[model samples]
Target: RVIEITLTSPMPDFLRLLAQPEMGIFLDGSGAGPMVRSDESDGQPLLLTPLPPEARGFPAREQWQSRARQVAVSAMPANSAVDAFAAGEVDLVLNGRLSNLPLADTGPLTRGTIRLDAALGVFGLVVRSDDGFLAEPLNRQALSLAVDRSNLLQPFNVGGWQSTSWIVPRELANGAAAQGERWPNLSFEQRRDIARQRVAAWERAEGEELVLRIGLPDGPGSDTLFTQLAGNFTQVGITAVRAGLREGAELELHDRLARFYSPRWFLNQFHCRLELGLCSEEADDLVEQSIVESDAQLKAQFLATAHNQLIDSEIFIPLGAPVRWSLVRGNITGFEENRWGLHPLFPLSQPPT
Candidate 1:
């Protein structure tokens, strides 16, 4: 049986899944496969193509038109997709960024629900290790002290409780305290004074300006944050150069700092690499040990030790934790919320009548 699934937008992950053997679904033009449709010459399945507005007069559309069942896949700005779902124009919707929108107690869209999961992403700051000024622990600590994390979360309405720690929240084994409680209390002005004193002493010893390059994505929000951070650093006698880069540009080791998110496994590997300088014998051994340790407690301890070492070295300055949410129809079944906030579709099915 062909199960017609509609997505609000296309993502590479979903497209790849459709081509998997277990799914038993085939593209329309491709003949004789695991899945079939009524119109095909053999027992093959139909692959429907959505012609998004961006595809207008494009060669790709001609290819899609000849091969698959055509449908409109126009860009629905944010909440507009919810309206389309309400009108029964589509069967399934894929949304990545859903803010805090309240759901109705009961409605026609009763059989579907939303799942929140950690988007394979991370956001943090990276300092150039070669910068002699940044090499000092006090300098790194002072830089961390200057960030206003609360203001950062205002746009997304998520991630304001505390700054991020070296360990990922869901993976941390021990019952740790709230991240906000770990840091010392110091006002922004006071923090600047502390950093200034430390930097002054360092400049006297080294006889050089403590200049830093702050690489930021060229955007309004990033610009605002960069300005604020630059101002804060300037107050502490740190000269900051705001270098704007195109999205997805390759940053060299000497480039200012950058922050991004990745899958948990990748992030763990990254932590090991940054601490152990990547692919070194020490990093490889530690990673192997953590994975193979049979005892849960021992494994936890090992990971914690790794985390502590990374934090103490200041490989990356963690900014804050992510708060995520999802919206679903009233009748959606089998959707469970996990610590990481990821919702897999395999476990979910339409509610029984």
Candidate 2:
């Protein structure tokens, strides 16, 4: 039977629905449903595909037949969406945060049903370069070293996360820094030792204790991270007070996701000449050079230099990569783990006959 199903929404809603199997759309593979025709939505275009052979036995098959495997996709927030998935009201939860998956392993559901993709984005700390005493590169490096990047993922209850030492994750570089070029290369013990000496020296020179305030957005993730960092900073004799959502705080934690493989997006965020007042002339020069460079190899080289310069300055302390977990049920297939953190919707559907 030829089935024509169309499901679409605004950009975000469309992307979310596109990621779920119930929509009969997959990004990476030819969907189980052969698409006959598609109508463009105001946002992303909608795809029309036939139902999978396996779905012929679905309990709700009757409801979907009216439109030939058509499935209703509603815009749902994170919590409600997850709850619906667990209750079997939905077949999948797309692009869900790992922290929200704790209940996924509860009575009715188990961890096995969850899929995690540690997107190429980074979770890290941002320091104001113009801020007093704390703005010093040595001081910033000490503070950065004091943090235990592993603890950043402790509250998520998921594993397979990696601690990063560079602002851009290696995956974004296409493995160019895989051999340790991007990493700061200091062991935690060595960092801790250096941090202690640096902080003590700074305090000795300034004739005062090294105290700093940390700012973070309001959320469970921020709360957990702040606590962990505060403890780590204490070990190095730096007093870190939770500043709580304050704008322009001396140090702030942040998360940035790359929409595509471009160094500009990552580099622009820290450009000193930008409004953030976090500037480094050398870093800025490299960034400007990289953007204008015509040669592909030279562009990459300039960008890498800029990235390394930023790391040496330690203005941004790389913590851990952001994690995303999804829950999938049924015989649907075609979900592949990707480094870009993208879950293609076209590839998700019933296995081919």
Candidate 3:
């Protein structure tokens, strides 16, 4: 059986690179034989091996199966793929870029045809610096407090945009013992006011103004997010400017999908060894302990503690789950909506029973 898949990407080479041995998202001793590639000019075909029913992570009633012996892949721009899909040239097209998202709902497309995976992951800015005005913990907390997360995606108006102020997803956390989000009792106005005072105190002490540079990917969605963020910073008496990713911005957007569902998975992203940002060594220690701490109950305790520590550190500003969407014809089979935002290629080629 031969299956053809169209993947829309600005640089599809990135997909092949990430699937390399020991380089994929998960590091759990699982070797990297699983991959998705197809005949390019080299005439080599990449195949996907379906995981057995018992080997699956996310719960599903259907059994996993593969119907494709050969997979053919075509990579093109988002617009081209959208056009092809709308014209019924392809049965499926997977693309996830806010700038290129086709949400106009025209042609044969409707809300029913579009699939947004409720992907579990991070989608916000990580504070990449520990110097200057951000050196103070109070100021960093204030930065988080000032923004109304719900306003960040007002321009895109995408549905089901879950805004968050916590480190771990509420669903995955053993954080039942803990209280709710930071400054829980405070309103958005009150939080902004407090943030303003904190920035004022810092300026008075240093006798200078405070400026923040945010590095965001190019897109209208990013533009809207930055504008809202800039407004929040302005309210707190701090200057906000857009900077290139390599221009040494204090805050860089960190967007990634979780490979599996676990609070520990979320916390490890901030481990000190990764140097992702200003992370706590104590948090790192807790994560290391959770790895071998046999007792499941105690392990949850350790992970919960580590998550709280990182949340308090405010290294990464929590926005919401990463948004991923795909266009599929109604007859397309096996496009299960999983939290990882990954729709495998082999299963997608299966014929509906």
Point out where model 2 deviates above 4 Å: 1-68, 75-77, 98-107, 150-157, 171-178, 181-186, 204-209, 243-248, 262-265, 272-277, 331-334, 344-353
How high a TM-score does candidate 1 get? 0.53
- Global lDDT of each model? 0.48, 0.67, 0.73
Better of 1 and 3 by lDDT: 3
Write down the TM-score of every candidate. Answer: 0.53, 0.69, 0.77
On TM-score, the stronger of 1 and 2 is: 2
Best candidate (score: lDDT): 3
Range of the 10 consecutive residues with the lowest summed lDDT in candidate 2: 7-16
RMSD of 2: 9.3
Q: Which model scores highest in TM-score?
A: 3
What is the per-residue lDDT of model 1 for residues 37-62, given as tens digits with 9 covering 90 to 100? Answer: 23534433233333432343344433
Ranking by lDDT: 3, 2, 1
Residue 114 in candidate 3 has what lDDT?
79
